[model samples]
Target: MKRIISQCSKELSQFKRDRLTLALAFLLPLITLFIFGFAIRLEAKNIPLVIQDYDRSPISQRYVAKLFATNQFIFVPWSVNDSVEIALDRAIAKAGIIIPPEFSRRIAAGNIADVQVLVDGTDSNNARVIKNSIKATTNDFMQSEGLIPETNLLTTRSRLWFNPARQESLYIVPGVYAVVLWIFPSLLSAIAMVREKERQTILQVYASSMTSTELILGKGLAYLIVSLGIALVVMGIGAIVFRLSFAGDPTPLLVAIPIYLWASVMFGTMLGTRTTNQNAAVQGVALVGFLTALLLSGFIYPLSNIPFPLSLLPNVIPARYFIEITRDAYVRGTGWIGVWFAELMIFAIGMFFFNVARRVLSKMQLTE
Candidate 1:
């Protein structure tokens, strides 16, 4: 215990004096948190739309007004002679609406009025949003104008449950916490280990009275403490900047935060043991930690969308489980019963990381 504390104190003392490392530990993470929080948006908005109105009638004008009123579409000026095809081909507009000359006349004649909507299919997801928005606007126009039959057989009284306002930040920022926390702590710890090798101080540690387990635990503890500080500052800023509030019990997050950070530190330590230089250590953590947390963890995209075989990787990923815990606390609010398994997974992965790092160190001692 005394040796472990001594090692931890040495790490913290060294860490405190290094300005660049301090900035790396604190500054870079805040920057990353803000960048990911404000920048990444899944829901499409402000679609550029071109409109060709041939009817010049009151009803046709009303329909056009309805489309512009919503936050969905912004108008792109189109000449009387120019076709919507030209705008689409130029990539100027993502969608185009053509109201035929007989638009109002067809309604009066009891015929179905077709409003042709041309959407750019370059991005399949954006194209789908444009199509759905146009369809929904048309349906709303018919209902408001008494064009559709008032009678309905079955309808969904649908309500957006957790996020009624559909604010993208609410869904995005919490996940940003997971990614930011995972990347920085691991990188910091990994670099700390590799730095010893670069400075040749690791030779003294190899010949020291400290066992592999003691040395690993002491270093891991120091970084874990630093990570907690990072977590608080980053998450507090996220709460203020994004206007995030807990929807359910906060207990799950409290329990999971330390476990997740320890796992991240341990994982970095493992990479540090495997690599001889700081550059190699950083690349290893970025490739393994950043890539998995960002892509495979369902932070931006759904895990289901990830193809099979690769999908199996998330089961062992600490960030994958931590994100589940965070999103649950901030968005879903399901509490311990809902996310207990995820927290357990984080703890299990952390142990696995610590074991790998210890065994590697023990092997190194024997080899030396």
Candidate 2:
């Protein structure tokens, strides 16, 4: 016990002495949280809309007013001589509405009036939202003006579950926590071990009376505690800055975080043993662990949306499972029954990596 404590103390002291590592351990998570939180928003607002009204009628003006009433679009003035294509080409407007000549006359005669809508498809997501808003606004105008009967052909109401307001921050903040834990703990541990190897200090440990198991535990435990503190800081930032809510029981999340951190530390330790230098260790952790978590861990995209063999790839990514566990605990508020399987999977993976790293250390000790 004394030897393990000494090892833990030694690693902590080393971490404190290294200014770069200490900054990364504490500041990286906060920086990542702020960047992703403020920058990546899904909701579309204030889309630029240009109108070419050839009709110049009261009805045409009313239609334009109704569309702008939704606050989803801002009207950009267009003259009859100005071309719609020019506005789109110059990026002055995302969409253009053209009310053809005799529009009010055609409506009065009970004949279909043609309206042309030109949309810039460069950003498909924003274009889709703008199209839907226009459709809803037109429908409301038709109903209010007695152009359409009050009785609808099909009336539909949607009830959103879990996140009723559908705020992007609600979905993103929890995933950011997964990303922070995935990157920092692994990077810190990998650099620590590789630095020791580079300095030839690992030889002293190999010759010491302390077993390989104690060495691994002592080093891992220290980082694990530091990582947990980082996680709490991230969660607090999310709650305070983004107004993220913990809707469900937080027990599963509390339990799963350390388990994920264990897997991360062991994975880093294994990479450290394979690499010859701290640079290689950092590169390996970033390419193998951080990028995998960022892209494939169901963070930015849905697993179901990704097809066949690609969808199956996330099964091997530990962050995918941790992200699921986090969402279940913080967003859905599920109990152990909901998250036990994911928790077990993380534990199994952690144990596998931990044992592999222990074996490598044991071999190193024997050979030295």
lDDT of 1 by residue, 1-368 (tens): 99989999999999999999999999999999888887787888888999999998999999999998878899999986999999999999999999899998998999988888899999998899888888898899889989878888877688888888988887788888999999999999999998988998887988877799999999999999999999999999889988899989998999999999999999999999999999999999889899999998989988999888988998988888888888889888999999999988999889999999999999987776
lDDT of each: 0.91, 0.86
TM-score of model 2 (CA atoms)? 0.92
Model 1 spans with C-alpha error above 4 angstroms: none
Model 2 residue runs over 4 Å out of place are none
* Candidate with the greatest TM-score versus the true structure: 1
Q: Give the backbone clash total of model 2.
A: 1
Error (Å) of candidate 1 at residue 359 is 0.7
> Per-prediction TM-score, please?
0.98, 0.92
Q: How far in Å is the alpha carbon of 155 misplaced in model 2?
A: 2.2
Candidate 1 TM-score over all chains jointly: 0.98
